[model samples]
Target: MSTQTQTETIVLQPTPHTEANTNENESTQDQSPPEVKWMYPKILSAGLSFFVAGVNDGSLGSILPYVIRSYDISTDMVAVLYGTTFFGWLVAALTNSTMTQYLDLGPILCLGAAIQILAHVLRVWLPPFGLFAVTFFLASLGQAYNDTHANTFVASLHGAHRYLGFIHAMYMAGCLVGPFVATGVASANVDSKWYLFYVFPLGVGIANLALVGASFRDRMASALTSSRRRERRERNASGGALKEIKETLSISGVWLLSWMVEYLVNVRDGDVKQMGYVPAGFYGGAFLGRLLLAEPTHRFGERRMIFIYAVLCLGLQLIFWLVPNIITEAVAVSLLGLFMGPFFATGISVGTKIFPPELQSSAIAFVFVFGQIGGSVFPALTGIIATRVGVQVLQPMLVGLIGASGLSWLILPKDAELHRD
Candidate 1:
């Protein structure tokens, strides 16, 4: 049954469940709690986790030149990193709900942090080529767990769009810093030891672990006890999760939004070049965009406002394509980033509002998985296309992606992106 929404903020409510499940699972922590004081700390921890993920993800572009030279790998071999990162997220996306069943949120976050830290540690020593590629797997898994749960957790709070922006902006902030630090470290040594860049994220990853543990101490209790009740809870959780997954996949907006983010980032050679300074501007633009979403979104409802922003993004992307000047290109790219920054988090916000609490964890996980599939497939696809068609193809390719992204935003439900499951 569809849960109708009269206002944009009404997304906090979930789809109606059967009477039996509603009463039994009513305490499922999907609503904003009456007690708001402690939530701030947990939210801060969640933001920090996204920061770590940004650093890890952002460092790769800066360090890739070094990897190619040092490892003597062909361009095709580099695709392995994307594959590993994709699969790592795929694994986390698949197993995250099950882990939630067996472990509390705090421990699960700690597990992700630990894995990311391990990946960075291995990188600092300049592991073998194959081993270095595998590190991305560890990093992506760590990111998916901490950030996805953090997103769902924050979406449950009051004024969710604001908090969602806070965490996602923290991610952009990390992306802004990652390449800056990586470039400096890699260029410093006479030997050009790009591996040293991992050290920065390693320290941050350790701090992320501490913050999650300290902030979420109340929910950190071990949940490994075996019993009939535990077994029943797992079974119920699994069943609800499957239902949510089915419903989430049925929504066109979910898939469209996922493709938007992937296309924007992956098609680097198209209208956008891998110019270091220009990309930094884009990340910085995204930082400001996410941080400042409240006023406009409130003034014009989210559904309508987001569509406007997307149309503006398409226009900016066109300017980037047609203008021959580097300065114009830089300005257009940055502005484009500003408009497109909210794509991923907005989709997650819709999922939280539409799916029931029992269905949410799994459904969100699957949505995340689809959001990521393009990241795995697009980099290699773009590279091969670039090799065959020349970099000029980026102009039209980007135009198509931006146009499609904007259209997809329009296709989302007018009422808080509601979907009847």
Candidate 2:
């Protein structure tokens, strides 16, 4: 049977036997405690997890100079840090679905939270440079798990597009906060006390764990168990993780979006290289764009509007490239960020619509892993190339990436019906 057909059967499967058994099932369900709804608290907690991830991701660039100073390392050496991050996401991509088969959602989330906490604990003490790099791997693994699951859960809810926007906005909010915090802590001591900034996320990580536990406690085990059983039954016909990974990777949308985000984040700041605060404007623009553009993008249609946004981003990149003034470059970069902000969430949203329901989690996880690849590989490549050529190459590189992203969107499979807002 086809994967979609098999999934439909699993979902529509009837209870064995007859009316009495059906009545008994209904009675049992009626007596059971009310199902945990996707209440505000649950949504908020999910958003917080993404927020934590954002802070971790955002702080790196801002504090990188401090790290370079403290470790006496060259800029190119920082590629190792991003390399470790890709490793973490790779591990998550390989293991996420398999882990879900054996563990409940709550436990999985807790595990991710614990991993992040451990990373922060290591960071707070100003460990060796090697250890610091290891911390990113640990943290990225945690983020991969937390973010993939949280995104899947949120995307399944009512008004999912809006909620996805809100959660991603929270992530941007964290990214926005990270720079200020890292810069502040770094400047205050100027003696390598910048590592102390990790203490902030350490506290936030604990709260993230607590909130995930509390909010998901009721349904985590049962829901995950049922999901696994269904997945197992389907696996025989559909193949397993390898098959799903192949399917996800085959999707052109995944690769294109990955390239877009990678270039957008890594290259946009190339013009004003030393000013750490400048990238924050990019993130801030992304934050606002996700918040403000969610509705318009949906109203106009994801595929169409995304292409429009990409064109706008390309225009901004050209201006940033040709413009001589740093102020103009910064403004262009921020506008580029604004245009690019909705791409990630929208891409995932489209994935959910395009992929089979049973494969959504694995598919989304795989897409995200590819994104991590882009995020890590392109930046490292940029760093290596910038050392030889000038950082000025970032502009034309961004233009190429943006153009490719638009073309990719143009060719992605069009849904017969748009997902309701």
Candidate 3:
């Protein structure tokens, strides 16, 4: 039974833009689908999942200090909790390449949301340390599915690079809001501040489930062709999971980008926010970056803007490291955030331009997985060093990482093409 039906299919990532649909008559040269209605609402709905994830992840990180205090845990032990989520992301990336082959958005998203709710509830119970890590991993498992699938779905509907800003910005908006809400709840002297966080996932899950159920009717179908089917059947004998992973890792660019993100978070973040003002500044900058600067940045030039951003980030890091005053440091930190805010989303756009649609998911996931590795590995290393060299010196070391990101971007294969439109 050959499932093969010959038709040329082009898969678009972030968003789909086709030459057939391009209109020369339109004055504005926007590549987006013209005369489309209802699409915006659907995009927003899909982005809401990222929003939920942002809040959940951000709030947890914001109040982690409290969690540590309450549990009387050491920094090393607490770092494990952070590392656990990274491992979850890594596993999800590896698994998703195969998982996307068999699953549809509706069921997988619903299941992910349910798992998140369960993880939140389990966290409130204050289980043992190992149990806590397991629960976090469970939540991350859901997050990975939701995040990757949502991006893929949205990309299928529209030009992914153009609209990815809106999606990522919404996520950043949630990240900004989560801390505010969590802090407010935690301040009320209520034994249940953490409990309030669960309310979001619960309500969101119910709504998302309904939304997905209705929308699945028009969604794209994933059907394997006979050739692909044969490939899969033989995949087991052809080196199996090990082969799959090796093939994925063989993509040099993905590993390079991933390592870049890893360096940024693990190494640079310490310097950026050693005094706690960096997140506030960065998120604010991110809000403006996505909301205000994203289009112009993309329209005029994405690659040039990125280069400029990297240079500015390097300077900001120097200021944050050298300036002794809290006020001055805060100012520099905020400015740094403004420039650095657009890095990931812009990079995503660049990637969408580089990779074909069919390979987009794996490419996106590959970079993210590497970023997570950096996220997990560097932070733990910093913690170990912080004990001996003191946390203050970690700031200068962080500057080095930010510089590394810039250097990596310079070495990118097609830096010249990045500025094309």
Q: State each model's CA lDDT, in order.
A: 0.64, 0.68, 0.55
* Whole-model lDDT, model 2: 0.68
TM-score of each: 0.79, 0.81, 0.74
Tell me, by lDDT, which candidate is best: 2
Per-residue lDDT of candidate 3, residues 1-421 (tens digit): 1101100011112223221123535553664534333466556666777777767655654455446556776555656765677777666655653544444445666666667767776765556768877776877777766666666555444455556777877766766676566655554564635445556655665666566555543443354445444433342222211212212121111111112212333444533113222344555666667767677777767656666877887898688667665567657756776776676666666665555444554454444444545555666565566556644545655676676666655544554455443
Q: What's the true lDDT of residue 6 in model 3?
A: 6
* Superposition TM-score, candidate 1 onto the true structure: 0.79
Candidate 2: tens digits of C-alpha lDDT, residues 121-179: 99998799999999989998998778766776666555678888899888888887877
For each of the candidates, the C-alpha root-mean-square deviation to the true structure, in angstroms, is: 7.3, 6.6, 8.0
Query: Candidate 3, residue 3: CA error in Å?
Result: 31
Weakest lDDT window of 10 consecutive positions for candidate 3: 1-10
Task: For residue 121, give model 3's deviation from the true position in Å.
Answer: 2.0
- What lDDT is reached at residue 109 by model 1? 79
Candidate 1 segments exceeding 4 Å error:
1-32, 224-274, 390-395, 416-421
Q: Candidate 2 — worst ten consecutive residues by lDDT sum?
A: 12-21
| Candidate closest to the true structure, highest TM-score | 2
